[model samples]
Target chain A: MAVLTDADIEALGLTLRLATTVTVLLLLLGLPLAWWLAHTRSRWRRPITAVVALPLVLPPTVLGFYLLMLLGPDGAVGRAMAALGLAALPFTFKGLVVASMLYSLPFVVQPLQNAFEAVGNRPLEVAACLRAGPLDRFFSIALPLALPGVLTAAVLGFAHTVGEFGVVLMIGGNIPGQTRVLSMRIYDHVQAGEYHQANVLSLCLLVVSFAALLAMSLLRTRRHSRD
Target chain B: MTDSPHGLEAKLAWRSGALAFDIDLSLPAQGITALFGPSGAGKTSCLRAIAGLEQHASGRVSFGSDVWQDSSHRVFLPPHRRRIGYVFQEPSLFTHRSVVGNLDFGYRRAGRPVHLDRDGLIDRFGLRPLLERRIDNLSGGERQRVSMVQALLSDPALLLFDEPLSALDGAARSDLMGCLESLHATLKVPMVYVSHNVDEVARLADHLVLMEAGHVVAQGNLQETLTRLDLPPALGEAVGTVIDGQVVDYDAHDQLIALEFVGGRLWLPYRHESVGQRLRCRIGARDVVLTKAPQEGTSALNQLPCRIVAVADADHPSQVLVQLDAGGSTLLARITRRSWHELALSPGSAVWAQVKAVALGL
Candidate 1:
């Protein structure tokens, strides 16, 4: 049986890096979108919410297939990147980042949206009356009050990105130390009939994901009791 | 602070689904103005409009010279821009922050000079030990006390209270009542208070705006409005008269204070109010006894010579409510059909009103 190799170590590092990048990007992009989804009374609220939540139900392979086409060399985004003197995004580290962000969008946004909704209107009204403007109220009141939800979102987003396989497989074609994350390395090991190496990588993913989900559930229960 | 000579003048109209409001009121610039009405009467909506919290409301609101809202001219100042402090029905203290942090949220945003600084309010509201405590541990009354202190610390030019004490039980309500009274005495900020309880309105409001079905049926000085014979019928049986008086003397031996009004002197249970301090004494119609002539044998503390101004139908068909003009002030007396018929009461008949009891309103 092969011991923990340098290739496995690099794959682990790359997975963590991609998950971190994707989680950070999702939080930045998802917070305002979640806030709008939570509070808006507009006609578009339901449709927009449905679109943001589509990833949860859509097959990851199908999503990956579409994303592959979108980032392919004659695609609109691909051509624009080429015009800007940049390589096409597919099969690159940056391409994996984009794919992971989409895969984890629902994981980050749903909890945050629920958290913002749970804050209710009364606190914001009180803050407004207390001379807190919109931004001031969000940072001082909404953000802090919704902290538990934010934590859940972060954990779920990071974990989901870390364990992601189909989207990464389709968009991030195996490339050592670039887009060959742990899941991809595990796939490589299993296809080569190296069952021991595959089992090791798979166990690491299972343990980490389980720990993260356990923490999330514990956080949720604590929050519910506090309420 | 700018003197709001016109007090608060709002001509606001709001429509949300089936409930709609059309209100035009001019409140006194100083002291508390209680918006008295039943639920769904649009009292809160009107108050929210004045505070710039009701989005659908359109019209003008001018506090003295400053125009807070004028939809016609598109001059609408948002809530944060307007120096108004509003306390909601619930005590919405920041759960994540310590008490001191919650207080500082308003204090830091207060661009105007601090009227009551943090330590000063903490001392005044007895919140020193609670400064570092988390808000979740506070009782309902304690949370409301902190809320009041927070609003006061901001030094609001105009304060809006929407049933701030409704969430508290009897003891907590009275405790916050005392705090509110003291805060009103200290700050003297123009306040628009919304309440369904008539007792609260009688005790705190200097100006009264009566609303029903989304309309201001009557608005005037609290003393005058309460006594007005033609008040909106929606006021129902809570109708009473507010007699403005002063504590001329306190009979220490009798445990009563001599409250002298324009009509006469009423001896009521002495509170801690000093002599010469003004008071608003609420005498309910049910509490006033009508007599043809002043009698000396009765144990009642007050009897005033009054002329029957009008005899109106009471909500209960069995009773007739007689309006009496005692000297310059007005008094309401709910007398039975037997007494009304036996005494032969008329619009201009001479009579003496015996007030058996008077509840001191603030």
Candidate 2:
């Protein structure tokens, strides 16, 4: 009984790529959205905040069902993609990236929002008086002060995307070298009574998660001591 | 002191919750103009409006012809766009930056033709040893010094200070006051400072804008405004006289320096100031003693023959305040009810006013 096979290696590699791509995209998109959510006094703040945090409490199947309908050939997004000369997104690597991002949205956004709130407006006001424009102040003062929060958000988003299963199962549909990530592969192995293969893949995920969590705790201690 | 109106000209009307104020002011070109009032008197609001920080306010704010906020023209510049530096009540420094990094932020962002000398300012403000230190680790006074130096390095056109010393202890306040007084002497940019402290206002302000409730009670030259007799009844007890003059002579043996004003002179305890340096000192009304005749056996260093100009009721019923004219200068004397009746003190009554050497605040 082989513990690790060639298919397992490809699945883990795809999982890493998907995790990295999703985490990077979320950071870039979530930063400005989180910043706006933290500081805005507009009437839509509560509604928007609840929407962003919906993924945290909503069952992954609920999100996956809606996403599946939205990405189907006759769906609005699929129509737009076809008009742009592209294929439908379901069961593809790009589709997994998209689904993983939706699953991990709150993991990336909430930490950054909390960090931005902690930084407050006083330092920004002081920067303005010192002749820093809006964008300049954000990059120079707000970002540096919120560095610890940003690091935490990045790690959480990466780990969460790697661990997600339900949403990826619904949209990605277990396509090898495309969307058969480590989590889906482990599920397939267990269903086929390949207990040894499932155990090995499960142990790999457990180690990666443990290492990431350990790194998070160590970074938190270093930040606390510095502060 | 030219005849033309210059420096900051602001006509602002603002309301914050239940408190509201409308102030029309024109401050001078150079030197410190203090916005002095009690808390809730809109002193800080005036400073904020001038700095383009108060958005609720309407009307116009112009610093020496450069309009910062003009509601009429719909021209409202943001803080970074306007060349102004603001120092808050607390030392709101960037906690992420080191002292040197904070200084460099200002030095690099300032536009061309920077007039401030960075090295000399660093030495003057005693920030050499703390260059690499984190802002959070600095003491309150040290942080404030860094905040001020940070503002100065930006080469601002106008500097606004909103009770910068109100957060410090007595000892720290005194030390920072010394630094601020020295900085005021050399600062080329105009300043609008806000404080409720009478002593701080008297020591630092060349001009004063006094406020109460939401109104400007008085605003003019420091000496003229402090000596005005028709001040608001709420400020009756604080009525005194301010004298601005040069140190004409100093007697080291007696530790007294003779200060000459427009039409009179007074001797105060020496504090190691060189001759010919201008001094602005205040004398409380209660410190002036009026005698019918000059006493030779008195230890008081100042005795001037002044004629009674007017007598007004003081805040206390048991005392009366008398105004006197010693040639061209005006002096205030606070005396008891009994003394006023017994001496037959009236207008044109020539009397000798004795001012104690230590009673004058410099």
Over 4 Å off, model 2: B112-114, B233-238, B248-256, B296-301, B311-320, B335-342
Of candidate 1 chain A, the 10-residue stretch with the lowest lDDT total is A1-10
Please write out the lDDT profile of model 1 over residues B310-354, one tens digit for every residue.
Answer: 887777778877888888888888889889999988899999988
**Model 1 bad stretches (over 4 Å):** A217-227, B1-4, B112-117, B249-254, B271-277, B296-299, B358-362
* Complex DockQ per candidate: 0.77, 0.76
Per-residue C-alpha lDDT of model 1 across residues A1-227, encoded as one tens digit per residue:
25779999999999999999999999999899999999899999999888889999998888888998888887888888888999989999999999889889999999999999999888898888889999998998899889988998999999999988999889998999999999999999999999999999999999999999899899889877875
* TM-score for each predicted model, relative to the true structure: 0.94, 0.93
lDDT, residue B84, candidate 2: 84
TM-score of chain B of 1: 0.91
Candidate that would win on TM-score: 1
What proportion of the real contacts between chains A and B does each prediction keep? 0.82, 0.80
**Count: clashes, candidate 1:** 1
Query: Cα deviation of B207 in candidate 1 (Å)?
Result: 1.1
Candidate 2 vs. true structure, TM-score: 0.93
All-Cα superposition RMSD per candidate: 2.5, 2.5
